[model samples]
Target: MQQPEPLIPLAVPPDWQDAGSAILGGDGVRRVLVLGAPDAGKSSFCRLVLQQASRRGRPASLLDVDLGQKQLGPPACVTLGLADAAGGVPGLCALSFQGSLEPLAAWPRLIPGTARLAAAAPPGLLLVNTSGLLKGAGRRLKAAKIAALRPDLLVAIGADAALEAVLADHPHIPVRRLARPAQAVRKGGNRRRRLRAEAFAAYFAPAPAWPIDLAGLRMEQAGVTPWPAPRQLVALLDGAGHDLALALVEAPDEPHRLRLRAPRVESPVAGLRWGGLWLDPGWNAHEIPRPPRA
Candidate 1:
């Protein structure tokens, strides 16, 4: 028997012309949500739509809600940016999530984060690139976002029926389904983890180690674990849960303070959450799921 084709490829499908037409067709302002399973060409499709829209000189904004597969910002963040943002990376601003790569673990944050980031966009068309968590809780999470955002068009890029539940729940909203891209490369678990480490390193590259005085720090939310007394990774967040800095916390010399090895930061720290990850001096990461659940 002949071998079957792989699920995803590194190139977009040849029939993408229809996808573009259906997406950009007859629109004053197209509010779109491009969603699908992991490596199902969600990001590729988003870039394609943006390119086509730009050629027509139509302005557009982006709400990157995929914490794991993110091009708009570092992993564990939801970034809001413009199509033609002047600066590099186009990261206008970011919302801190649960510091997780998988969508289910971070769904609680993704729901509110999507709305908050979308709200930051100017009044015009928007394209939301979502995490590829399209079954079970993932479907429910994505569906909830559609309900809250009420986008005009939904572009689902794969043949999977995972999005059907969302579409049925939202019968009123229009949906367009496109085949998975011909060249969407699917990376294995190790590759994904390595990519995350690279992103983490890059995000913290600009600034050096900084410290925080826990005695004066006020937190609106925190992890359940007992505060670390030794070196451990943590995410510094604002009241809105946007990560301001990533650091390695060292035992404090003073009762009210903790030391951090991180980059320069501007946002005031409203809270600190212990990272389920441990980053050595080399910045390599390993996961620790059940860190502090108290």
Candidate 2:
């Protein structure tokens, strides 16, 4: 593959510049996992690494495991993108739907989904960019991801005791610690929510409502009860279990069928799994409360 063309130059910290160069300078580092708290410049650092690799004519890929603020594809999905630096975010190559915006709520799907997508990345320097969830259980999730991916290098981007704790779990892997660059702007909670809302709106903007018959396809709600109300998010899965598209529930016109506002599904939908949120037509997301313990 032709090396990805360079985008606008990024002004990162001097140490970050050296780290990016060193990574591509060929010390036998292939798979790299970048971790840090929110707004710590993990994504920016990955972009820098990609640009450096591109300049050197090295093929590189990015596995975006951040469901909320993704570098490619929509929120709530782990996407693999071949590094094409011409665009701000790499082009979408593959994805796995975790169905939750928060990494904590999605760990069951997050770790394995990341591993699966990382496995599918095209051969080259695979840079895995993860969600900035580094407190409490989030710390364990980060460590679990490292254990699963077993990346050649772990790039922790900020100073957090939690980050050190995670690094301690895997002593064998080489690590590069860098301060969060000044360019990294800390987004407030409300700002983050607005960003997610905008992303959802952009993703579904051109989609038309599609009606699906449940007669032949498998329907999986599993532990979810009372059936999902209108506007619930759902994932239509292919036979091999990859997501075909995400749809919002609409009132069914017929029994044993579902109407959804989603992009056209070109391939057959073998099954669908219910998500734990409701997304209104206006793109606002509301969590679906879990059923009371039996």
Candidate 3:
């Protein structure tokens, strides 16, 4: 007996097509969640999938929920438009709850709305982009919530150990780990440079924001202090119904920490960065300390 061929070399969606390849190839509608750490290329992967779907004469839409950072926009800071990429299909209809004032307080009302919008959309493939969280029990809880949504497929990008671990714990959902294009680039001088440059360009380009609820939330340029200490921040986030990115944190005697917490998960403080600076909310100075890894 011969073994079956693996589903490698997945098809890419085409340009100017309606319905994504996933839907076309499936017996029913397909819904996917693209999970990854910050800068893990989840959005890019989604675009590739949409492009492949387009190529196959199928239409798909992305439901952006990375509200803390508006990576996707109609007037995209980057070249790709989520809607245009889907052949003008409506994409990403909600905001992420991160950075919003009282996101936890507002999530109950907001998530249902997002679900309703997703449910109302035409049958096809629906892709969701998620945020990266630090390590902790909080991150685990967030992953569990997302899994509860029952995405037909889940794709985890970069070093998202926590997300992958949580999804794997479920045992019923299908998951895939995608490689970064830069990592796939053939090693050498010119090609490597070009690949790195392209990746950088894509990284800097503004994308759509994660759909989150911010009804009672307020944005403050200054970092949180006194009330939400680093540990408290972690706990608050662990308890929060919405996702939270530990943008910057400042402690009087401790090394400044930049923490990113997903809806219910808490990630490590050391890995987070903004523009090469170890994002220390505690460090108010314009200049940030460089990590030893950098």
For model 1, residues 1-294, the per-residue Cα lDDT tens digits are 101123224565766656765666666545788878788877677766666667666666778887775666566667777776321234345455555566677677767767877877876668888887777787788788887777888887777777676677777877877887656767798877776667666765654565677754554333334665354567777776566755667568576777776655677787777645555655556555574557
Task: Name the runs in model 2 displaced over 4 angstroms.
Answer: 1-10, 85-87, 222-228
- Among these predicted structures, which one has the highest TM-score? 2
lDDT of each: 0.67, 0.79, 0.41
Full ranking by TM-score: 2, 1, 3
Which structure among the candidates has the greatest lDDT?
2
Each candidate's TM vs. the true structure?
0.80, 0.89, 0.46
Encode model 2's per-residue lDDT on 18-131: one tens digit a residue. 998888885778899998988787778888888788777888998988888866667888888886754245676677778688888888888888888888888889999998
- Ranking of candidates on lDDT, top first: 2, 1, 3
Model 2 CA RMSD to the hidden true structure, in angstroms: 3.6
Off by over 4 Å in 1: 1-30, 85-89, 228-233, 239-255, 261-267, 289-294
Prediction RMSDs, each to the true structure: 5.9, 3.6, 13.8
